[model samples]
Target: MNGLIGKKIGMTSVYDSTGKSVACTVIEAGPCVVTQVKTEQTDGYTALQLAYGDTKAKNTSKPLQGHFEKANTEPKHKLVEFRDFSIVEKAIGEIIKVDDVFNEGDMVHAVGVTKGKGFQGVVKRYGFAGVGGATHGQHNRQRAPGSMGASSYPSRVFKGKRLPGRTGGDNVKVKNLKVLKVFADQNLILIKGAIPGHKGAYVILEKK
Candidate 1:
């Protein structure tokens, strides 16, 4: 109940009460079904497992198919467990909508995977200014990561160096994003500024 499974529905801009334009990220939140309810007596902890997005049963595994059947719901594409959920009375198979948890102006956190940019340089990945300019016969070194280590002191690149190999595709949690608008009828929530992940990527919106 503290959070809901959602899909990033892209971004848009809206005007506030002061007529100021504000950037917002649209998220299709909830209508998620409670697939399982864990209790301290049974599971050693309290949690609610919510499932969202429909999936074909043919593509689902036998164990997951039986799990969905136990909940009396169709196969879902995404399942997230929220520990110490605010709504403990929610039974399995109960539907939780976007309006059930969030409201306009509420501060929330968005957790998602960022977009992947593979095999990048330090300039793009870590904002390094790169090597010196092309002047003085410095060729093909503009975007290179310079001076990895000393010539003989260490002789090797130290661990955790900031040289880029892969970029993005990280689990990021953007905290305290204000809920700009909530269209419960459409099950969409507009949050202020940008959240992590690409369009259609799954995200978790948690109450702050």
Candidate 2:
């Protein structure tokens, strides 16, 4: 009710009412099955577990297979729980489609994992300008993180230094993205602007 599990399909440009081209991200939002319902009395919380994307039963764990069987549905690749779900009365195995939750012009928040950029330097990771030009013996120091800390005052690098190791692959939430279109027949929704994650990655779209 409050949100739905979705997958990032890709990006495309659509013309708005003003005939201006607007870039949008396409998402396959549900046809998700209600897999579990947790009540405050039972679990000390109210949430609805929704499952999306199909997977082979052989690839699914036995416990998960049994869980899906209880809902009268096949194994799913992604399962997300919506806390304080608005539709608490939805029976298990009820399908929540894109149109059932979102409408065109509605604002929503998209939560996803950003693309992973492994082992990057500060220049790429934190958008640090390279250390000056290639002159003055600064050949290898161009992309190096300059002046980490005072050598005498702080013998070691600070805990939260800007020096980069791993970059991205973070759980990110982009808020207030307007819904451009919703195709219930195809179970797809087009959202204005970009969201996190790569194509085919799972995303959660929450109504604002």
Candidate 3:
């Protein structure tokens, strides 16, 4: 379950060796520091707690400050756990880079929050075709979820019925994205296909 915490750097099209443009999402992966190493004997699970991104000491809490200090690193804005990291032997305070966990042509998955669309209607949220042939005052009820319930059947609208409500802003996982390129010098990674969330959104990438 080796993985890395990264940030979405936006999308771009890159040409492969065959000279065909391939759309990909650029990500800034780590040089993540191992903040804590959990073991089955002590924590009931095996996981590596990694920290990434620079942060001012004053902006971080005292508890987090002590944690980073134990690892002998500066305060990091993002902290993620990679459970059962089996790619290699990792020690406390060790550095793991993008290339260390992934390589070109490797199949991977990305997890992140989808872009929030805020409140939405059934037509846009659930792709409801909506009522048609505006008849019997149906014009105004086109998008409305017609009839809540039968007069005397269920006696109430059924729970979990699809209706107008908030859309997006959920955890989305895009699986089997190819590792298009890796820039170890700049700590940037290019993954094939679109990933959810806006630019600068935190993303978790793990090998499939």
Candidate 4:
């Protein structure tokens, strides 16, 4: 996939050319540096390793420091690779801007880790109907799972049964989102709709 790394800068609504309001995710996309280029004969695959977000030398370890040195650039907060660079032709230390690969009305995909909601209930996690009788005789059946297993027929809870436990904090991908705007001066690329993860979170943007 043709992609780049970016930071989510929160969401906002914007009016399109037709004066239609659209929800958009503001992202501080690349101006990423091409750290390394690998070819089939050398690395057995064609890819360009990109680095984004500057990090101080004091914060980076020696091995990572050397890696940045190989790129002849400062330490970066993240690194990712793209398979094809024929359209980019980026060299080591070459900067990649958001406008280089994305523009208004272009379809793109974003991948990010969703916000965590720890230890959810069956009703909240699996959308199961909770035990009823809120007024009759129920005391605390509102959020209970109620019947999980059969009485004597099944002594133990069945495996793979839908039950509430941990929730969210998972990798999620939002696909075919239209690029609403690309602010090259600010390195911001706005896409239509809400994206996974919170503001300032790292996300991967891929052209779809």
Q: How many backbone clashes does every candidate have?
A: 0, 0, 0, 0
Q: lDDT tens string, model 1, 115-143?
A: 99998989999999878889999999988
**Best by lDDT, which number?**
1
Candidate 1 vs candidate 4: which has greater TM-score?
1
Model 2 Cα RMSD, 1 decimal: 1.3
Better of 1 and 2 by TM-score: 1
Q: Which 10-residue window in model 3 sums to the lowest lDDT?
A: 139-148
| Better structure of 2 and 3 per TM-score | 2
TM-scores across all candidates? 0.96, 0.95, 0.91, 0.93
Q: What does candidate 4's lDDT look like per residue over 1-208, in tens digits?
A: 6778999989889987799998888999988888988888888878888899888999999998998998889999999888866554667878888888888889998999998899999998988788987999989888888887788888999899888899999999999999988899999998988899977889999998
Best by TM-score: 1
**Model 3 misplaced regions, further than 4 Å:** none
Model 4 spans > 4 angstroms off: none
Write candidate 3's Cα lDDT for 19-73 as tens digits.
9999999999998999999888899988899898899999999999999999999
Off by over 4 Å in 2: none
* Candidates in order: C-alpha RMSD to true structure: 1.2, 1.3, 1.9, 1.6
RMSD of 1: 1.2
lDDT of candidates 1 onward, in order: 0.94, 0.93, 0.90, 0.88
* Model 1 misplaced regions, further than 4 Å: none
